[model samples]
Target chain A: MARLVEVDDAADPRLADYRDLRDVGLRRSLEAEHGLFLAEGEKVVRRAVEAGYPPRSFLMAPRWLDGLADVLATSDAPCFVVSESLAEEVTGFHVHRGALASLRRLPLPALDEVLREARTVVVLEDLVDHTNVGAVVRNAAALGVDAVLLAPRCADPLYRRAVKVAMGAVFAMPWTRLSDWYDALPSLSARGFTTVALSLAEDSEDLEAAVAGVDRLALVLGGEGHGLSERWTDTADRRARIAMSRGVEVGVDSLNAAAAAAVACYVARARSAGA
Target chain B: MARLVEVDDAADPRLADYRDLRDVGLRRSLEAEHGLFLAEGEKVVRRAVEAGYPPRSFLMAPRWLDGLADVLATSDAPCFVVSESLAEEVTGFHVHRGALASLRRLPLPALDEVLREARTVVVLEDLVDHTNVGAVVRNAAALGVDAVLLAPRCADPLYRRAVKVAMGAVFAMPWTRLSDWYDALPSLSARGFTTVALSLAEDSEDLEAAVAGVDRLALVLGGEGHGLSERWTDTADRRARIAMSRGVEVGVDSLNAAAAAAVACYVARARSAGA
Candidate 1:
């Protein structure tokens, strides 16, 4: 069972992990080194508990501590109950959700192992926006994508905003960061996976056609600005696009990377089901 | 041709409409009464110009003023070319896009008029987040949704953040707010439209089956907190759900409203194409 600790001091040394989160650069640096991520909201924290990401500690308004007593009973982490004003002062923002949990992030599964056990996976390249990254992970979990592999330059899925936006699905979904983009392509292909890059190129096949009957597929999505690099395009088995109607220019040549990821994930899941 | 003017002061009276935009509530109130909205970036401004929402005035960096020479040649509004620092001071932020256009909101087409000419439409009920609103508009445009009808509680489509997030599709798509929700249902049904409400109710039909061979379809999406309202569900010809894979606990009952909107739009478009 988790220990309940009453904290009145806003500058407790034990709560350093949850401090100054608004400074994203510093927070990300901390995450990269310590592998600790924060999950907010009662529901998300509950899920984290159920998923075996036993919290290291919790900060919450006194009102929520009783409500979360059931979930807190399962973990041995110390729970610090503070006044709402003090909680806000410590977190540097209005903590509307009333409860928060800080958990140590687990090391991601090896890409080869994930691919071997997966039928549907998403390969994200250089997607920088934290919200989009979170949304993509949430969609992946919802639509049955087995894993997500991030290439160099992708945003940290464990970032606090990403964790909140993803509703803790980032913790649930299998993900890893690969340092080498080009080298990972052929290894995935050699594992009986078809590497399909999503693009709007003239020679690209329709997204529907590309996902028709592939049992094992890796749907590759690029960043919001510049899409997949030339090396990725050259290595992909095919490039596909969602068919768009006329008189509908959304300024960009393609959908937001996360939106595109959802569509591609859906198509791949649908095709896999049919097969 | 647009009259080129140079402004050196941030407090210029002509720039009143572009001031204090970071205060969302105040800005919204101003937009409501004045019926004016701001568009950022050269691409969105160019689209606005082409769409004939003639700019009331432009606040631009010197470099952007030179880049948009062709577009400026046809407009009759004042184009204020200022130093980047002055532009930033006037706009209350660093104008990274280097240009902004204030446009008079054109009279919205009547709901009936949009319905009369449209084969597919999206009815958004109380979708309040500017980012989600923008994303839905972008998806609606790309997926061949002919129009978007907003309920009273829906956020203003022309809100600056929404316009920016949408990549300015708010200017391209025909949209208007509806005064009556219940009364509007019959008029749509009378026009040979199939009213499909996206929901996850037990009795709801599959989205794929619900949209098969539909001529004119009105997809109704509800707010993030609540799914479709009870009134909307009662009025809908069919309540539909996107099918999820077996054995996956979605944790949440439905996709994010914007994600759901995109899926619903794509399904309707695909069905219409097949028909």
Candidate 2:
């Protein structure tokens, strides 16, 4: 069981990990050095505990503690009970969700291991937006994609906003970050997975036709502004596009990359099921 | 050709339409009363103009006036060119996009008009988030859904954020608010359209199967937080769900309604093409 500690001071040194979250530099540096991520709201905190990413500590209003008693009973960390105003003052914003948990960041799984057992996986290339990253994970979880592989330059999936937007699916899905994207493609192919790049190029096969009869597949998605890199286009087994109807012009000529990722994943899953 | 005027004051009476936009209540009320919406950035503004949404007026920096000379030449409205600082002061933030246009909202086509000529359309139900609404429209445009029918409870498709997020698709796509959703369904059916509601119900058919061989179709999508209402569900000719793979627990049982709408649109288009 976790130890319940009562805190009345807004300036308590023990709450440093939970402070100044909106300051990018301070938060990013702390994440980089200490490898910690925040899970906000009661539901996500409960999910974190269930996922075994047990909280190191929790900060909540005294009135809200009873609601979390079941989750707290299973946690081995310190639970701090504070006044709502004091909690707000300490955290630099009104904690509207009533409770928050700080969890230790876990190292990503090995790419080879994730690929070995997966039939459908997503490879994200340089997707930097945290909201997009979160949404992609949410889609992945919903549509039954087995895992997510992040290429270099992708944002952290455990970022606070990402966690909130994903509704804690980041804790549930298997994900890994790869430093070398080119070297990663052949191994995926070696596992009998087709490395499909999503692009808007004319030479690309229609997405509906390309996804047929694949036993194992990796749908490679790109960043927001830039589509997949030329290197990826050349390396992928096939490049595919969603067919567009007449008089319908996507003003920017493509869907948001995260939106594209979700569509691609759904297509891949459907194709796999058909096979 | 539009006349360009130089303005130095942030508080200029002519700039009333563009002032204090960060205030949600004032902006919403203005949008509701005047049936006007703002489009930001050079790309969106240019698209809006090209799509024939006449600009009521424009607030711009001197740099944009020179760059968008061709587009500016076509509009009859007054174009106020101000310094970047003054533009920022009026907009309540840095005007990095350099130009903004306010457009008078036009009447949407009747439901029968949209359905009569359409092979594929999206019927949105209570999708209240402006960003999600914009995203759905962008996807509908890209994926070739012929029109968007906004239920009464849905967000204003012409709200500033919706227009910007949609990349100006609000101006490009054929959309209208449905005053009576239940009465309108029979009209849609009269036009040879099959109304398929995207739901997660037990008896729902797979999305792939639901869309197969349907020439004229209207996909009903609901808000992200709440799935389709019972009333909407009861009216649907068919209930369909995106297929998920085995052994993957979809921790979050739903996709972002916009994302779901995109996938549904893609599936419907693919099925129609296959038929």
Judged by DockQ cut-offs, the docking class of candidate 1 is: acceptable
lDDT of 2 by residue, A122-198 (tens): 98888998899999999888888888999888888888888988888988888889878776676677778888889
What is the per-residue lDDT of model 2 for residues B147-171, given as tens digits with 9 covering 90 to 100? Answer: 8998888998788788877888878
TM-score for chain A, prediction 2: 0.94
Model 2 spans > 4 angstroms off: A190-192, A247-252, A272-275, B182-187, B246-250, B272-275
Worst 10 residues of 2 chain A by lDDT: A244-253
Model 1: residue A159 alpha-carbon error in angstroms: 1.3
lDDT (Cα, tens digit) per residue for candidate 1, span B57-121: 88887889777889899889999878998877767788889889889988888877887789999
Per-candidate Cα lDDT values, in order, are 0.82, 0.83
In candidate 1 chain B, where is summed lDDT lowest over 10 consecutive residues? B245-254
Which candidate should be chosen as best, given TM-score against the real structure?
A: 1
